[model samples]
Target: MVSTTFEDLNNSKKKLITDALLNEFSHHTLSTAQVSRIVKESGIARGAFYKYFDNLTDAYNYLYHFALQDIHQTITTDYHKKFQPDDYVDQVREFTEKSTNSRYFELVKMHLLFNEAHFSTPVSNHLIIENEFYWATQVLIHDAIKQLMLDPSSKELILQKLANVLHRLAKEDD
Candidate 1:
């Protein structure tokens, strides 16, 4: 979580810090990130970095969530309502296209490639045991995104494979 002091900063100052953090995290994993670099890039004192975040992880989480929100806004599907496999695929496609083209691309790629596994906290998997279909869909969608990141040229093929599996699962659920 960001500190109140960070939230209180003016828009320009906030952008400077956040943009600096984004650039740092995008190029390096959490373990390798340096506050010295962030402060230098943002033109802030080293002490100010501590004032804005509890630590490096907090800063990373803040930036990650901010990127998520920005990407989510580009999705056209209404997640609040129930959706079909096609709708889910459309959402995934939109997310892939938008994130790949956005400033957060490297940040997102680094998260998927390295940062997620390094974090001590595990991603929630209760849904796997509770709803197999939904869990499978989530897995397929995530893997597709991973594939896209690894081999962007295979986006269509990967998405098609995911769609095929999801469609089969949806049919079985009937």
Candidate 2:
């Protein structure tokens, strides 16, 4: 199989459309995401939107890559090197609070809430980064949990149920 290069991946018009689509889809449901609004926000002509993408769903799929890129960065760049279970909880809490200012936080939140078809096309740069981030987090947490099992002092109850805790915190505040 022939390999694709960065030049093949560069599409400025498509990226612009995808960026606009991410903002729109995050603010509204899939059914309600308006192409006109996306075009208007992107400052691109309506025809240009279709020229770059097949339709709204195509646009959304493209936008998913962008959101995944942002999330992958957040998970990897902000992750702690040393596992302090309580510190992990506090960091996630701080992230939850800081998410209000994150441009793509709504998209990330929506992704966690609803199940949908994942973006299928390979986004060469971000896809690999995301895979690495996901696997690294899983491995780190697994090791941490294992270590916690060995030492009572290393274990923190609050960290064990962080997912449930964050969900509850968001639900209560929203």
The local lDDT score (0 to 100) that residue 26 gets in candidate 1 is: 99
Report how far off residue 146 is in candidate 1 (Å).
0.8
TM-score of 2: 0.48
lDDT of 1 at 148: 91
What does candidate 1's lDDT look like per residue over 1-174, in tens digits? Answer: 799999999999999999999999999999999999999999999999999998899999999989989998867644335539888888888998989999999999999999987554333454446467777777788889988987899988888988899999989867
Candidate 1 runs further than 4 Å off: 76-83, 119-126
What candidate 2 gets wrong by more than 4 Å, as runs, is 1-18, 74-101, 115-158, 162-174
Q: What is the C-alpha lDDT profile of model 2 across 1-174, one tens digit per residue?
A: 111321253588556655677788888776678999999987888876666667777666657665656544554434335433445555444444344346766775665344243433333334356544444444444344344333436345535665444444435444
Instruction: Output the TM-score of candidate 1.
Output: 0.91
Which 10 consecutive positions of candidate 2 have the poorest summed lDDT? 1-10
